[model samples]
Target: MSHHSKAKQLLQQRDELDEKVKELLLVLETNNSTMDSPLVDAEGYPLNTIDVYAVRHARHDLICLRNDRAQWTEKIVEEMEQDEEKMGESAPIEEKPVHRTSNEPFVKVSSVVELSPADVGGFRKEDLIIQYGNLHHGNFKNMQQVAEITKEYENKTIRVTVIRDHRPVRLEISPKKWSGPGLLGCNIVPIAGANV
Candidate 1:
């Protein structure tokens, strides 16, 4: 297959892996919450052991899949860069749908309110915000920039790049006033030692 086709396939597989990871997380959360008692079905058949074991197995599979996806993503980027070089390009530049490879923790999501834009946009707990629209890299000044941008672009869709469990996931979030308090309804804190 061509590099482009392979990259597309890898991206699709990565997205599927991400969804599986999310589902596994839900399973783990459910199992943990019911640790005091056995999980049961409609007929009250005990399913705690099965549920826990399934979650554990899913977690292991999630790790392997995430690693594979990460490698594929890297290979795709490398292939793209090589293609660009062949076209006389000497430097790698940021393009639309930017995939950040930075390990610099910019912000850590503290909380996400239910039914909010952040929650609706798949912002989960412990997500590391790498970039959001114009808040990428050295563009953002502080953590308050997220709120400022959200309020400024209320009801407009913007790209948000985040790292969850060492994987980069880009999300599009429309800032809007739902039936809640804030526009995005998410609380985030700057990472320690980051130039906030």
Candidate 2:
């Protein structure tokens, strides 16, 4: 099969895996449980309120599906890289001016509470926040600005851009009431010496 065809097939598989992960997450939510939530009581007995069996199964499935997705993603990337290499061999490359900006990442995500808005929005720990709604490295002043923005866009989706593993990932997060204390339920700290 061609590289393009392989990439397309991998992408479809990844999408299907994502859907399965979402379904498992819903099952966990229905049981009022997070991945780390204890299924047993203090005395080592299964909790009476939650369906421990279902939750355990959902969590296990989620883990497996996530691993599958990661492998699919790597395969897709490899296929795309091969395609790029083939194209580069046939065409002359044109150099474009690189625009360098001093706008560095201002805030770093320290933690994300499971099942919270941030978690649901795909926020991960150690993610460097380059943009949060209208706040960016150039205009961001402090954590207070982030708080204000979150309050202003309550229940509304806000575009968030973070650098994870040296790649930019964009996410839409809405601050809303949940089982967590804060809207985001994520801790962010300003980067030292970073322009805010």
Candidate 3:
């Protein structure tokens, strides 16, 4: 199979695995138990409050599934790198100046609070955001979209792409409860004349 096809298949499998992992985590949450939570009481007897068997099974499966997902992610990244190499080999050698007519950065990071989610996620001031979660320049309307995405993906990692030092950098940021006020604790302002 072609690298593109393989990558697509791997992505589908990864997404399926991710859904399964979420389901298992939900099971653990429903039981009011975490992976490290003690299934047995102080006397070494199984706790009557939660189903020890189900929690144990869920935790075990979660570990295995997470490992599998990591493997899939590695394969996907390899396939993507191979695809990029293949494309580069066939492309012309001439380098043309890039014109940011479309897909221009829609927002810029003005400030990032210390020790916040954005700070922990490697966000820096002046980072030009090209993509956040599913919102990109083409579909992005306003800051409200960014707000909605952060709200929707709270406690979950969101893939963000930014231009830092004229290079595209990918970072994973999760919006979650922290010591800070906001979820991200970053100030993002729309770029001027970006048609936001």
Identify the candidate with maximal TM-score: 1
- Judged by lDDT relative to the true structure, which candidate is superior, 2 or 3? 3
Give the lowest summed-lDDT range of ten residues in model 1: 89-98
User: Please, what are the lDDT tens digits per residue for candidate 1 over residues 1-196?
Assistant: 3755765676677777778878877776766732233446678876645565666576677678767766765665555545545565322255344445543557878999988998999998888777777676556568678778788879877777677654567677888978988888888887777621
What tens-digit string does per-residue lDDT give for candidate 2 at 17-38? 8788889899999989999999
Per-model TM-score versus the true fold: 0.52, 0.48, 0.49
lDDT of each: 0.69, 0.78, 0.80
Model 2 alpha-carbon miss at residue 20, Å:
38
* Model 2 TM-score, 2 decimals: 0.48
TM-score of 3: 0.49
RMSD of each: 10.8, 14.0, 15.6
Instruction: Report lDDT (Cα) of residue 124, candidate 3.
Output: 99
Candidate 3 residue-pair clash tally: 0
* Whole-structure CA lDDT of model 1: 0.69
Q: Which stretches of candidate 2 lie over 4 Å from their true place?
A: 1-103, 194-196
